[model samples]
Target: MTILDLPAAEAIRFAVPASRWDDAYAAGMSEAELLLYRSNLLGSDLTVTNFGGGNTSAKIMETDPLTGEAVPVLWVKGSGGDIGSMKLDGFATLYQDKLLGLEGHYAGDQDDDKMVGFLPHCTFNLNGRAASIDTPLHSLLPHRHIDHVHPDAIIALAASSNGEAVTREIWGDEIGWLPWKRPGFTLGIMIRDFARANPQAKGAMLAGHGIICWADTAKDCYEQTVRLISQAAEYLNTRLAGQPAFGGAAISPLTGRAAIASSLMPRLRGLMPNADNASRRKVGHFADDAETLEFVCSHDFSRLAALGTSCPDHFLRTKIAPLVLDPARLDDDTYLAQSLEDYRALYAAYYQRCKRANSPAMRDANPVVVLVPGVGRFTFAGDKATARIAGEFYLNAINVMRGAEAIGDYVALDEQEAFDIEYWLLEEAKLQRMPAPRPMVGRIALVTGGAGGIGAATAARMLREGACVMLADRDAAAVEEVRAGFARQFGKDVVRAVACDVTDEAQVSEAFAACSREFGGLDMLVANAGIASSAPIEQTTLELWNRNYDVLAQGYFLTAKHAWPLLKAMKEQGGTSVVFIGSKNAVAAAAGASAYASAKAAANHLARCLALEGAPEGIRVNVVNPDAVIRGSRIWDGDWRRERAASNGIDPGEELEAHYRNRSLLKRDVLPEDIAEAAYWLASDASAKSTGNMINVDAGNVQAFTR
Candidate 1:
């Protein structure tokens, strides 16, 4: 039945996920396909399991390719994959008998690493997929199909002090319970023995962990897992019906909480102490849903948060605990700095108290999660995706805490146990295996006139190197369409669009604010918006002169002015820059283009002034002068092209490009991408030490060359 079919009052509080299995669709599927179907269904709902936090498996008979005889193979979810999104190849296949045979060589807990090394030996047909730590947990069970998942409801019960009694109260003898132990061969054997002894048990709860259940059929195992979680959610909801979550609110949520979070995050990001000079800069995500607000504003927030998260998945993503901020002093920079300093010291002390001789070296001590009372939660990571996922994991942790406290006293994993898991060799190996960070990883940029050819090209190049970009253009619809294309090519997470006229003061301020709100701060600003006017000094009207200066000169001034505070805050983080798209006419006088040339000249001088003013704070400002960039240039689409062609005595249709090419020293045709390459270099670390300089992308125009 659907959740809506439940009694009205119960349905309102129900947090369970209904099964989405379609029997007709599963009718013709093979055993392995059915296993994948079960996994996708289970993982599709967060109430069923979290991202990358669960594994599913099936034991099936397959003909050995060499022997032409049937053999049982174990297929389990591989390491570092999300079950819901994985394809058939995501499963790691091994000889079930060989996987079980490894126990004969297992000495004890000390052989945990050694056992992981042995899994590859059991690979079926030399499948290259690596097995996860939970592979043994799935293989040792007697049933043919098994599901091991960490739903918030199930985790709440597992992490509660009275979990065993509560579990029995709900399910009687159908479910069993086991004491806490680290997941390894020993724990696998414990679960194996427990299942063997309890012949009538459908599933068992691992103390302070999650649940494991099994059945003879894939559908049966999937249904059993969902049923158990649904039951847990119902029981917890009943107990929590009238209970105040986290002992009621200690503070009211602030009005304009989002505005406050947007203001605070960039400063918060800046104040975090770096692990080293080469550490990846962190991006941020802000969450203010009712659940997050309730937990952050609760009377018991400090007490419970200090105890930390019980689930390893949550702990590893969010750190041992979040650093809570005082809502009253959120705007106080001194207070924020001191709080961050204290947190680093405390984290270092924790590592010192728990390190073993073989422990991986201490990591960056900055808190990944930050709690702002009355506002919401902020999570930071080396990229946008991880920052968003870390916030999701913390929200799950909050649900677990809410449920556990409703049932009984909430318990966290012991500190030393937490340390061992955090610094585990296997976990460290996984981190080390990650590909090196992209050149622009963790950088955020804003491009004005972003719907145009050069702006879009520059944005794409930065996104390719892993930077989040905000496209600000006067054409709202055009910029959105360009943004959609970028989102398609390079995930929706790293790109956002804001309709803005760069010449307007208020709009420019809000655009930079939107960048901070979306990705936590600005690392670079591309002052590229412009208007072209082809007129001699006598032919140029006051309106044309003002319009050209408004966009080309004042526009650069406004965007750079708005981006200053963020750039200063990120000074120590490094690579803060401003790249102005100036015209070649700014340096070399061009016939019949006095208004456009003079306005661009003003912008070029402004960059030099900003470069001088910003050098003390490590902010770099440079200019890229592009000449005769006719193809794909928005300015070239209008009368400017005809006016230039007429002045040069050439046809505007096709001869204009040839004439300009022939006049160039190198006879090269400059495209939008040519200008984008120069802008990208200035915006990146490659030009970190070069500023107040101009690069002319005019093929080989000696007249436009820097003096």
Candidate 2:
């Protein structure tokens, strides 16, 4: 098949509307926002093609007192955030001169220490965020826009058996392939120095990581990225298409069919929990496909585990590789046990071979893409976006290897070269500078329970923080009324309301899709729409259990599933964060609310698993478990309060006061605003380091009970 027939190649060319630029630029985006938008766009481009395995940047005019009024500023992508939803704050700004100075100060005595001092002079500090490690190189570039993307097709060529020769033939003059150096100022300086020597060169290829392309305009830069990858894809495709092929054969039996599948399925499901059984089956089948078996048998399946990333940034998604599975040789427990040892050995070898004399050791060695011998191939990522990226890289690598086999042999970058690029000092410095951005800005957020109380409060909170929000609820009139009121308060564009039933999957999907289409993409999700029905465990019938699950667990699952692609796309652009509005009952069980408690607990677990699975993709997932957000909620109405008071056998006012006073350590009722504040933090860059964590805004309710 031609390179165009390859999935990675096809995925890479997925067109983003040129109109997006017009929309973004016309939106009067701030300099910071523009930087963020461009960075994210580059990331999205790379992820769709390579799968969360690239970096991007932009250069803007900054006030330069030395130059009198205007000098170019370099705004490069940060380390911790996802490219898909990167905001203006996501790009670290550096003065051109300051970056150039970084190279001159790299003394042999203290590289890291010196690098830390250089960070503050840059414009990145203006926005109160850290700078990217690639800041120096990006600043050194003459171009206005730069994108360092690791297209799977290109990396396949870079890592091929004959990669060096193939690359030389295709890009001898226009592209420069540097011997691998650890990423940071050192690597940046290397590239900068090389580019200085070769004034005409447009970009460079880091032996193992990927390629860097720069140009005078965003379009030119993007075109260059596409051109180089397309050429590489075409070359590999043509080379492979001419080779002799083996017929399909059962090289190995599908052993440990149930056990291996079961163990792996949960992890996969965690990444895509709502994927139908059919989709899950497809992934499982592919893992044990004929090609996987053949590939496993052909290689030193044991030794192949040592390969480093297809590129460095891929670490954000793939996290090294898949666990190896060999059913015939070992039982379930034994197989699981051996996986860690295999991973460690592979990691050790890659580190030892790749580490520079004085640099820190490599962090992970297990291949993000795995071969399971008789089982098949598996790509491990926290989410589908990352999985898809790993899958693309693996497919391209396979094609490249096959082609190299035809051409005599594969020619991967030398071990030393790989190490150098991976540990490039300049690159590491950039990583230390920038912090992650808040999640909701530049995103469309939907709060399902938004018409009243918590949802309305969340909508206002997200809007104030720069998100376009859609408030959704089952009460159509209430939604409309709130929409008008919020529009009047926050301006017409900031908030909208949609009538929705959280229990209906079709409705939830449609609402989310509409929101994404209307406001670019959905980034922050608060699944707060729920009912709190109180009943003893004996009175909780099957219908009650099903009803609670429908709105609580199933609703979250469906909303997340439908929004996954968009969120993944946004994350690939930069980063996306999710906040699930859970209740204290999720962790602190109660006597009367069995169905509610069970569903909430399940939702909490789902959030944790999602956080683990989404991390590699740069999507942060967390839960805000709050207790008794009393003000403005339906439960606080006159009739409802009277009934609740009657049940508790007290005066209505006294019972209400007693409930709030008794439940919390602070002896105060939790306000919707308080919960909103917690949600805001979980959805922002402030919580980038935290995930799979539960933040309690319960006025110490849980703490009081526990104590």
Candidate 3:
């Protein structure tokens, strides 16, 4: 048999001996817990499984705590649970007999949605954890352990035109193959009948979907899955011998990289009209990585680009086909706009042609992944992780298709079959499992002092929760690095960066201008840029006070003054917010730090006055007073760390953080995320009515209390 080589697989085998599975069976941990453990092993590897790509289950007996009666239950992955970090509660426990009984009644009508809706009611757990749509299929399977995954290697064969012939060539009768079908009531019935027909087979492959492997033990089933996929990988490696990546498809961008970043990314964000002059859903973020670049730049791009996705799960994630940008028109905004319009029209037509009664409205017509010839494949999503999932999946898919093309023609389910799965209620239900977006979603935020500490953390946090962010800092390289990294992860529209000396009025104006140009306007302004450690009065020079006050005092003033118009305009949608990153020093002066203390104190008063002026314009101003947030903070970077360490009688590197950790009444180490969470809540609607206040985030600093 082939060997398991995935990193997650290796880690599991190392941590749990081969006998661990047997030990678990004897230990009396519920089957749900066992499945949860194994599911995490598989879900940890993106190469084998993505965010919600695969599921696991086992049938077992659980004794009722009250009656002491043994009962049969089917434990399946819940609808919205991530396999990697899933717990016992993440699995839905259903009465085995009731779950299996549903198969007999399903006539396959609008019942698809009804069946999913009724799953929670059937769940044995009273907490309302919903079962996945594939619960019935898992219940009907006779095997003790079952796993279903959309592995990249398996997808190459399953999606290929010659998959059946190739699958048989590789495994012969070891694995049975099924025609492309949306997973539901009828599909569950097929799995049952298929298993009965081939009692000796190891598992089954779901064409245009994924693979399933089953065995008496979780370890045995997992091993079999690895062996089967490894065999496929070996076959693929042989076929890829002579072909070069990006061989036939590569062409230069019509313009240069600088031009693309400066002009192309923004133009793509514009409102492009359809043939009827109606604009569709605006695209969100753009994502690209090294692998995505290779595929889009390959010479064989056209032939591969025309093919559909390797599996149907991606029809929900990436859609059927990514809109390929015209290579020659990369520099022309008008041509790009016209092309996007055409792309929307084509998608609308595709939906109309195949949509059945009760079909969900066609997903926004804009493409998720856009391939620019010279630039790379750009994945647009509502968030970074989704964008990465689509980009990563497609990049892997290209290799799978290359393998298939080497052996035979790469094929996918027909348009009708793909449409059926895309519109299926079971597939649509998965989205409901996602955590509700934060209140700041669809809003724009500009954060100053974003290079490190609270500023960087807040920018990332806001972007993750669904707000577009613009990061401003005088550290040019740091700002760009954060900007570029976040842009790649969250899409270009999701994050922007400007190297602005916040104390400079011109740079502040330019920062706001850039913010408006990218995201239209801003709803939240976090004036967090400041430096520390001014000399005491006796030793202080004119320069020390000016430098300290310029950043802590004037920086806050300039950012607020320049951002007011945009903040006021935010009233059309909702009230805007200004969160100043003040310090505990504002309320309590530290001796030998007159300039620093006085500067922050001035900034603190500025916030209160700004609140009075901004209240009339619906611009709520607030401040977060925090002390000593060390990690990822430049504030503790240089001479100050060594001096503080010496004063504490500890090593500079080892105990610098510990020295301050004890100063708080709570004795907790304040980190950047703590400050960020405070800023996030203030910027969100949670503090909509309560503004013009200062929140002390110092973990109980009574020295500055009651100020």
Candidate 4:
């Protein structure tokens, strides 16, 4: 049989992480540069460390700005920075001597919360990057260069019931072990004392935490860290041979898991509670890979998940525990709703049981991670990046659990300790210090004709305000180029592209489905795809009339008709919106454009009718009309510009825009950006109460004004 057909336990294997150091690359580098190179290499492997879950430090001599004398400085990864993607500026620099001197101010373990306040006072070189709480853990360690990372294999050993005994069995005197302690001044001191007493030891494992290794040179330190993790992984793999992980699988995975996830995501998102428009809404991500499916379908899944995660990093991201659901009953709405309520109630009780008088108020109690027995996992957070990262963190937890159970019983952290870390006052301050979220932070939008000028501009405005957008256009290459540019400017997680001809009903349906799959649901729809034809009534053939209707009229109908269900599902998220990009010709008649004007008029009326039907459900529909957006419009690059200019007795090449501008009552030029601004307002909550209305962006053309 093929490897894919084997059970997960039988297919499990662990490969040691190899060193990626290059002597030629590190030959002429300074101490700080070597530290960065080492950090990037170690963080490159997930088996070495998860994202933003570790810190590395180097004590180096640098010329003091104040005294012009060389002083020893400690450079470590700053708060909220991921080592995998960090640059030199990402490190927080502090005076090494000043950090060590703080040992005298330590009034004991109770002062851990206050000790963080003094880190800024020890800042070296006026670096503004904030030091993380783990600074003490690295600074107090008696070594010139140190690496502390949360590798899954090492954590599996650290989190097992017999962690100390197993650690001694594997490394003997080379590695030492310490009992569980929250990272702080005391833990650092404990590690320092342990290292001094056992100078022969290279590193120590902090029980239920992670491993640390040290050396005199940067290369030695990096190689030692890699060696210890590789050794632990090899030991685990040997012990796990012929042993079923998590007591073997209880249920086999079902087929078509993606389809199931897509079907359930919208309903799940709708059931979540949102306080108001000011509060950030949740965006969802789904994963159904083989590894995830194996754990979710295991026999011990329910029990182990209840125990929660051991590492502080894992616990903070995945929450105290995940909400588990039965795969068989997934189709039952009552069951799903009740399970969510049960999970929230238990979380509240946990908070009330463990809360101190000064503990931060309970945050949202909804589960960030959810497990389906026969499927995989679903994670939700305030944005796409966070949601996706949270999923990655949980996968690390899964690997830790699998390794721990393969050798011995996996031990979770104490409830009191978990609560203390989760509700730490220092962490609360960091949260409060974060910048306020933008207005469209968790919104998802889909724009038709996104390769064209107006659609692309509207999409950019939405993205700048923090919305995820899906660009659907018939010109696949042009749309992809736009998606790439936006992805670079915003982020890869927030923008996507799909080729679509709006006139085709099947393609339109699939486009909306793709949006739902990429993001949980749609919050806004911009029906902006269009075509133009300018011919006298007698000269307008049946083919021309049909082509105009197929795009401007039928295309809008198909897009809106498909967007209705997803928008209705997301109504609780500050209400949903549909902004139709109409034209001045829709309301004001022009001599030679009978077919184009009439089709646009049909689209305008469609918005009003939709508004009447959707008002009861909190869905708003509106229109934006433009008179002469000739600068970047795709329609103006062809026969339409010449036709209009010929009818108006002007040069089509140079005088077209000016002729249309002077004819307007306001005598001003109308541009694509002007139309985009109107569209943004109509879709945002600023215009929430006003729907079934038309906003004319025609430079004050009296004939086109709404009456």
TM-scores for all predictions: 0.96, 0.51, 0.68, 0.95
Residue 541 displacement in candidate 2 (angstroms): 13
Error of 2 at 169 (Å): 4.5
Ranking, TM-score, top scorer first = 1, 4, 3, 2
lDDT of 3 by residue, 349-379 (tens): 9999999998887776777777776666666
Residue lDDT tens for model 4, 132-156: 9889988998699999899989999
lDDT of 2 by residue, 233-292 (tens): 676666545333212222434575434543443233223221212111111113454434
Q: Compared with the true structure, what per-residue lDDT tens digits does model 1 show for residues 251-332?
A: 6778998788778988988876458435468899998988888787777788998988998888889889899988879889
Query: Model 2 scores what on Cα lDDT?
Result: 0.63
Q: Give the Cα-based TM-score of candidate 4 against the true structure.
A: 0.95
Q: After superposition, how far is residue 454 of candidate 1 from its true place, in Å?
A: 0.7
Cα lDDT computed for each candidate against the true fold: 0.89, 0.63, 0.73, 0.88
Ranking by lDDT: 1, 4, 3, 2
Candidates 2 and 3, the one with greater lDDT: 3
- What is the Cα-based lDDT of residue 331 in candidate 1? 80
